[model samples]
Target: MEFLAIILAAGKGSRLKSNLSKPLHEVAGYPLITWVSKAAHAAGASTQICVISPDEQQLYRELSHTMKTVIQVAPKGTGDAVRCCLPHIEKLPKDCPILILYADTPLIQADTLRDLANRIEAGTDICLVGFTADDPTG
Candidate 1:
């Protein structure tokens, strides 16, 4: 079955207080989106799509060289960004599974995604990628 990994990059990240898109921010010397994209590829995703703010088009193009980019014209809730990508989602084969991911958490590893993909390939209807924090007060 085909798999589409949707990375959400539409947030303005007010908490960050910088001009950069959250995912385009540097993490461990690499752009956060790069790490997320690596995990998506490792998870056996045939294609990767990123939902990003339309105004951030230049940033998106600079950061995500190998993935498909979907423009979300307005900043809204996570659900809204996903809705904006619905057309691309619908164009996929009916059986294809779409994995929704946030672009800021670069620490998520490839093996984590592999496990999710395994479960998905085995017919699981939905899967969420998560991590156990080493410490909450770090």
Candidate 2:
């Protein structure tokens, strides 16, 4: 199933207290966003778009070979980040499914994404993946 993967990588990750962007941080030798993009691709996402903050020129250069990107001019919230991709989204087919992903959550598996897409194909309008956390604290 062909779908568009919108990887939100614009967060400043202030809590991490690092000089690098959150998504640029390495996880098991690969950048966090790279893992997310790989899972999206393996899940049959024909197109992927990464939403990044204005100062992420290095991130842009790294991702240029894999997918398109849109910049969030301001450090707005998630909604604004997604809005930056509106023009590109408009060009896709109306029935095309869109999968929203977080770059920091690299543990997500491609099989899970494929299952969600399968649900969408089976006529579900939306499929969300979430888990109940015991503490729900950072």
Candidate 3:
């Protein structure tokens, strides 16, 4: 099935207590958002988009060369974040499967995303990719 991956990176990572953009924070040598975009590409995403806030645009534009970046000017919730991407989503083919992903979960794998899509292909209207976190606290 055709795939479209949307990676959300527009959040304010207040919990991390870092001056850097959260998605720019490195995990295992790569930025968290980069890991997500790579996984999406590996999982067969024909169109990949990484949504970011205006503050992050310059840095991500220089860094995320492979994935397209969409600007979310407002800091509304995820619903609003997804709405900012509708223009891109609408341009895609009707049957294409859109996968929503978060930038913070650097540990998330391509296999897990594929499994979620497979479930949808099999017949489910929707499926979530869940991972068992070893510890709940950051």
Candidate 4:
């Protein structure tokens, strides 16, 4: 089955304290978006789609020439960003799998993604990636 990826980068990231799109921010000497996209690519994604805010069009365009992008006129919730890629998803090969991810988590490893894809291929419907808490809150 073909694999497709959608990277959600439309959030306002109010806590970031700058006008730049959060995905454009550098993490370990590379833009957060780059790492996210590369992970998806390494995960066997045939195409990567990124949803960007209207103001971030130029930034998004300069990143990956082969990437598919959708403009989110308003900063909405994650679900809304997924909706923007619906049309593109619909045209994908039937039974094709689409992986959705955020642009902020640059530490995700390729093996992790491959494991997730393997599970999906083994008939799992949905999987959520998470981290274990080091300590319990009081």
Candidate 5:
């Protein structure tokens, strides 16, 4: 089945209390953005689009050619970030599966994503992934 991945990387990483953007922050040895993108690619997404703020666009320059980029003009919310990628979404086939992922969640595994898509292809109405947080407190 055809698949498209939309990685939300526009967040400012304010919660991390760091100057670096959330997507630019490193997880393990790679940037948070790279981990998510590589996972999406590994999961067999035909195309990947990473929505990021204009200022943080350069953080993903290496993937500019292979991965599509959408710039969020305003720092709205996740809903708005999704809207920023509407054009790219529209270009896809009407029935293509769209996988929405967050860049900051770098711990996600490729196998997990692949299984989600497989479930969808097998006739699930919609698939959602959840992780058990060690600490729920903010």
Candidate 6:
């Protein structure tokens, strides 16, 4: 099924206490955003848009070859980050499925995303993927 993957990656990573953006941080061999994009692509997303901050020039340059990007302008919230991609989203088909993902979550699997898309195709209005963590404390 054809779907749009909107990756929200505008966080300043203040919590990580690092100069590097959260998405640019490497989990294994690839950047976090790279892993997310790979899963999105494998799940059959026809279009992918990455939501980034204004100062993320390096992120923009890196993702330029594969996907489109929109600047969130301010670190308002997740809603505002997705809102920045409205122009690009509007151009897609009205009924097209949209999958919202976080770039920092590199552990998500492509099969999981495909299953979510399958649920949507099976007439589910909206699908949210989540897991119960044994230890919620960070």
Candidate 4 accuracy as lDDT: 0.81
Tens digit per residue, CA lDDT, model 6, 1-138? 888999998888887888777898998899999999999999999999999999999899888788999999989999898888889888988788889999988989999888888887788999988888789784
Clashing pairs in 1: none
TM-score of 6: 0.92
Residue-pair clashes, model 3 = 0
TM-score of each: 0.84, 0.92, 0.89, 0.86, 0.87, 0.92
On a 0 to 100 scale, what is the lDDT of residue 36 in model 3?
86
Off by over 4 Å in 3: none
The lowest-lDDT stretch of 10 consecutive residues in candidate 1 is: 129-138
Across residues 22-135, which tens digit of lDDT does each residue of candidate 4 receive? Answer: 888888899898898888888888888988888786567766585888877787788889899989988887667778888888988877777777777777899888987678
lDDT (Cα, tens digit) per residue for candidate 1, span 19-99: 777787888888888898888887678988888887787667775678888888878788888898788888888777777
Local lDDT at 47 for model 1: 87
RMSD of each: 2.3, 1.4, 1.7, 2.7, 1.9, 1.4
Query: Distance (Å) between predicted and true CA of 124, model 3?
Result: 1.7
- lDDT for position 114 in model 6: 86
- Candidate 3 lowest-lDDT run of ten: 57-66
Please give the TM-score that candidate 2 achieves against the real structure: 0.92
The digit string of per-residue lDDT tens for model 5 on 6-99 reads 9988877777887777787777999888888888888888999888888885566755876888889899998899899899888877767788
lDDT of 4 at 77: 80
Task: Put the candidates in TM-score order, highest first.
Answer: 6, 2, 3, 5, 4, 1
Q: CA lDDT, every prediction?
A: 0.80, 0.90, 0.82, 0.81, 0.82, 0.89
Q: List candidate 1 segments past 4 Å from native.
A: 132-138
